[model samples]
Target: MSLDSVAENILNHLWMISWQICILAIVVWGLCKVFSRSSASFRYWLWCIILLRLCLPGDFFQADREGYYIPNSLPTVWETPVTIEDALPENYTGSSSPIVNEPYISLHLSFPGVIVLLWGLCALFLGSIVILRAVYAYAQIKIYPRIEDPAILNLLEECQKSLGIKKHIEVLLSPKESDGPFLTGILFPKIILPQHVIHSWKEEELAPIVLHELAHLKRRDLVVNWLQILLQIVYFFHPVVWYINRKIYTERELICDDLAVFYLGGKRKRYTKTMLRVLQESNDVFSAFGAVGLAEKHHFLKTRIIRILDSKYLGYKKMKKLTLFILTLFAVCSIGVFGQQQTTATKAEGEVVVTYSIFTVQDGKEKSLNPEIFFLSGVDVKKQQKFAPGEYTLLISQAGYHHILKKISIPDGVKKFHIQEQIQPLRREIKKTSKDGVDIDVVIDGDFPAGERIDPEIVALNGKDVRDNVFQPGTYRLKISQPGYATIEEAVTIPKDAKTFVISRTLSTNVRKVITQISYDVQDNKRPQITMEKIGTKEKILINSDTKIKPDSYLLHIYQQHYFPIVSKVHVWPDDRPYVMQFQLVSKPVRIRLDVRYDDKKNLPQQLVTLSDLEGKAVQVVHDNHRIKPGKYMLNIQHPDYTFGREKYIQIHPGDQFLILEKMAKKASSPSGKEYTKLFFK
Candidate 1:
């Protein structure tokens, strides 16, 4: 094939594969939305799958097979060679035919050829721009000087140690003060920091900055950045690809932020403030060099800051192995479905001409086929058509007729074949009957007392008892009633078409007088406030004595000063007598004092004490008294000078309790010279 033909073929293949790539991209995008709350690294990795799929061929896992030829509305014409004697008529006296002596050639480019040329030129143009930008950024990097400050070097070393990174990384100071910190280079990874930041920022403030850049190295984001650039160069025309690229970059920064927060002992406020300051004072200039930065885009600053403060990001939970496996499996399956090549049909010389006809079987007789009938394959087989000798599925369908599908095979030696199928007409039976009474069943919807039997006579139709459970086909008033429930009154119509009718209703509770009494033990003789609330609703009514309220299942609540609130379920039945409920409220315990002391018996002041549930959720400390609900809790103590191990699991119960925690002696350094503190509580 000529070069143009070859290029056209490749372009056609790419165009086909581009749609498949788009499908995979959409699938990955949807999965990312589904797992939006998952780890940012997981989402980033999910986007990487699309990039990998884009590099695959269209028929990567497709199997070679024979194509099946099916006829369409267009008829195939065959031409035969004719001799000179056969071409001339018997009455013709023509001697010769006219001919031209001059010769000319016509050069024409096909539509596909033009498209291929355009695509090539556009790709070349964009690819050149990308290369030039990368070159310029790299050249700019060569002019920047590497930092040699001892304090900054020590801080970098400490950050590296904290992140457990063993790779040799270089630190460069940007020539301009507006440039932010970013990690560049794949082989020799270098971290570029703004000159002003290095001179003005404190070591404590710079720790998170260095840690964020080092995280990119630890996660090998630079390599992924190169892949992203390559995808952009290839699929530059695809808008979805650009959107996905933006999402990948956003998630990448979020992942780095998570890593930075984790290594900083989960101090998000300080790190977030530093990140905001850095982004505010810096500009995005290193991304063109294919580098990953802390804040690459100003618009993403809000998202980054919000995500930094989010508890989910702060927790930094890794994606589960099962979830990862499922996602990978789904992507692979999608590739298999979308990447498979479509079979091409080719006509053979030794094919058979087939004619098809349909007839309907009505009233036990064959009749002419309906004009509305057609084949499911969308082939109008009114004329004869050539087909390869193979098995084919014939789908004949029409309105008001049962669809028929028949399989037929044409023998190789056959020159012609006829396929005739009979379809059965659909018949529906309709019955006409005299109008009659319908059975009316009344159903009561409510929480009834267990083992309580309800009589059907409670329901009355048209102000009369419906003892027979049948009503004539006419409109009538329905009155449904039950004890402790408001009576329901409505007009209902019984239709002659339906054989039975059901009336279901939920009756509201009836209003009644309620009296509640509560007693509690306290230092002062004070009456607690009493309130009554209906179950499954937000309506609350204060009750003391002879308070008119709905009669149903309600919650009785009593609250007093220095006492635990009491809640009890009370059921009031319908009666003329006053409903009375009594309850005894328990008094709350005194405040629990937490005493933390060193081995020398000195109180540990300025220490942060927190009580959390077993699930790590902070428990509310009421009135600075540490009065919490009785349950098992984990106690955590934080101090700048002291090191606390894992949280202590403590069980709290009702009543007065005292906790005394004493610090043990510092253990000898295990060669690393790291001191450890152990606390025991009783």
Candidate 2:
């Protein structure tokens, strides 16, 4: 596949996964709210489920099935194998012929392509932001000095042991006093402390801070933080993702706080006091750098303080049963959301009830499949029967209709099978005879009016002479001939029940007469030579006043020296009346007459008038008349005696005669000068 197609597939998958995540997030949110009294650790795990679902690939739970079986064995009833060609009508010509020229292919972008392009660009932009932010965060943390104080190292080791964390973690001290203690890093985790907190705070007051930061390490929240960041970058356009990310962050902090309070010997007041002190002294710049900091926004801080101070909130035990139930529920729901069965045709072993209906193609009349004539593998079949799972060939033959032979397969699991077939009628030679003479009507180009009759010469039927337009009732190749019309030959069937068989045939004319009339916009004695060319042929025929040509559409090319050539399409039908083609040609040169109606005629000679074409090329004017090519031009008239020069835009068409009249003041006046411009045809 092309890159565009792959990207489009990814975009479609992302859209599907996005909505699925939205539903999962809503469900998890509702569960967390309903279990409000539960431990934050439980709610945190629920959000982790959302994160895990985001990482799942599309089609993770789809089923796979085998291919369907198609019956290929022929029936033994018909010893001679029948093919589709034998079932087709004798007059069937198949489909129409392909076009001579290749079709034009369009390069226009489709709507889905545009959408995919936009999605790719946005994803690339968000990805760039994420990478840059990560890089900047790494650089910011690298500058912090590593803490070497034995007292702080001992305190950290004590906290890690208390939290049952076995991994080795680094410690750093921030130089700025406003920076709070935050937990950063994944593989080599680090906890950065504010400079003032290390120097001013005592061991008792600082224990809660160290414990809170270590609690993040125990919960493996740094890894979850990375997942949240990845999802935020991928689903940047999705509002639900951002909402869920916020909830995860809030729940994550609360869970860590719970761990810190528990490790601090259940002294909620002491832990709460240290959290408030850290929040007061530090800003939230570390969180933007992907660090789990003690500082939070005012609203989130308020909720945290309220939850920590509430005596009953911390007393609630972890509901392990409820957590398990919710986990199982979400697991089932996830399976329902993402699980899809792979479609395949499978074969099975079972008896299939088969029913069939046959009909004539010409008329929608249903036909019966006789048991004696119609058979499946030489076994006589009924209207409906139970068949073992296997391939079988059915042969259906009617008197007038063509025989139908089909191969069908009965799969293992199919309970019922329906077969509907439309049979084409065969072209059988008519053997019936009629008594009275057969009446024949011949129409020349649909020209025969009502009650109007013209006798056309009857040629021959089946190579036998047609006597007085009468014939024995049988199928014959009827041939018709007329003086001005083309010959017509077709098969005709005569019925025995009818006293008189009527035949009607319409014939097209072979040749037509065309009359050409040429008129010019400008009166001239020059006559343009008109040539005619058929639509798809290269031969050009010269057309005179009266021309006789085949009945087809033609392109007429009329051209003369110093005149624009005219090309037009003319359709000549096969009719009695001559086709008349009228064309009007235009001359190449345009005429312009400039009449200067000035108060003083002597100033006209001093008027420097020039006409410039649209390209600013000047056209020479002689005797106040200019003959130039048809186009738009600028007419500028500048006189030393007038107050202002007159400039106007004019358009000249082929064979156009324009007269421009301009009245100018005799003397150069101030603001009250009068000027009149009038344009008309000569």
Candidate 3:
């Protein structure tokens, strides 16, 4: 990629990257709130993700792109997709199936250079503000006298000893009625104390004041502050980032307060009083610049005081180790969240979220329907949330009607979309309901969706199946005694005006089903299931088994994980036929040896080759070694001299013995390692 191309890529994705930073900042804020009462260490650690978001260029943990379809997209400059096209050689045309970029959306457009020029100006403007503040704060510090009292020196030694601070911090007296106290310096740190206050105070009150500054150093808030100060300039336009920066400082003070209290025991009353005193007389100390201070504005100071007295913060005292453990976990997550290339499009530009709330309209009003109340997992809009701006599917179920699945779109430009859905009239019979208007008949029927009836022997109502039929005008608790399926207790209410009460019970064999969707790398086979032998090809079962089978004593086994095989306990229905569950095979991981020929006499070029499978796991390509699963693969082969690869299309079949890839040896005047690559999309 040239310099112009690099600049163009960044400019093209400038809005998206900024949008992602804002979103991540909001996430950091929400996570901090959840762990608010827990510990400040974890809360401060959460901001590290935001830091990583700004520092790292790409996404870390990739969302699932298996079924997520990206239309007419191109990969970014940072992503080198080892697509099937890249694996094949030039002048080779075996499979004409289209191959695209991995999970990245790119558009080749003539972007005006003025956007970046204006960006530089805005960044410079913010950067100048931060610099001016630092200069102004440092200038204000110069007006104060350096303190050297023996008593104050002895108190400072005590704070350093207790806080495990080895670096010598210069303590200076602030001007009377000036900045109360603050530790400031981009390169070095100094704690400026109030002149009139410290001299009149004893060790007890003075210890918490100075220890608060030491806590800033111990927690490394200075480094975090400096980083935020710089990044604010980079993302000055995004207000979410400014909010996050404010949150960092607010939480930073609370953390220091807690640390001071933890280290200086039996001083909560004194510590709280000292913090209050500092806030009342607090000047433009740390508040005006990149420094840690005792207190800030009244609004933030009040929140800190309330949080300081919060006894719940002490509950996490014994769990400091757990906080450290969570910090470690967060650090580990940062590796995946920051280091990996993002292979999927998230909430991008012109995308909006659409949320749905379904209601049943009866005689005159709208009655809100809650899926949880009926133990149904219909469109869980409450928890599942509104999907991104795209076509979405929703399943709504009511007692009378068949489950309705409606496809809707979250149109662009709109932020929050409330889709009003009204329930339709019943088309299918409510088989799970009553039989007659007189007596209540308890019948075990098939599952709700499949409608396959299975007779469960042990059926009881309130532990008494003997008297479930024809009950009085009241509600009865009916239960089905089954093992695999959940214990279902459905209530049947017999109205005063009704004659017979019929209650139908739905029994499901499997609670969860894993559907393995298969995609042919070469072409669409239109087959639902594939055997291991006939993995990735046109060969399929090609038959729809329409014959109905009875849900008997045999267990319906299904697998969830790729390698995990599920087995169930033996049943007692006396049905003795083995049933096989099949999955559509997308790609097969087969062992193959690649024969790369340059010349009959010359040995193959010594280079490293690797391939990424459908699941995006990378495996090195060694001759006659390593088996890979079936899927679309990206291949990379490195050579010392001339370019030998292109955006070629090659399909590896299950029954194929081996593949012979040919490369012509061309002399190069200059070794442009990747100049021979194919066009992104054709």
What TM-scores do the predictions have?
0.44, 0.43, 0.41
Tens digits of lDDT, candidate 2, 211-249 = 988988887878888888877877778898888888889
**Candidates sorted by TM-score, descending order?**
1, 2, 3
Question: RMSDs, each prediction?
Answer: 26.7, 25.4, 27.2
Backbone collision tally, model 3:
25
| Top-scoring candidate (TM-score) | 1
Off by over 4 Å in 3: 1-7, 58-112, 282-288, 315-682
What lDDT does the true structure give each of the candidates?
A: 0.64, 0.64, 0.54
Reference-based lDDT, residue 438, model 3: 50
TM-score of 3: 0.41
Quote model 2's TM-score: 0.43
Worst ten in a row by lDDT for model 2: 95-104
Per-residue accuracy of model 1 over 427-513 as CA lDDT, tens digit each: 321222336756554434433331122343377889876654446778889888876677778898877677756565555656677
Residue 370 accuracy (lDDT) in model 2:
41
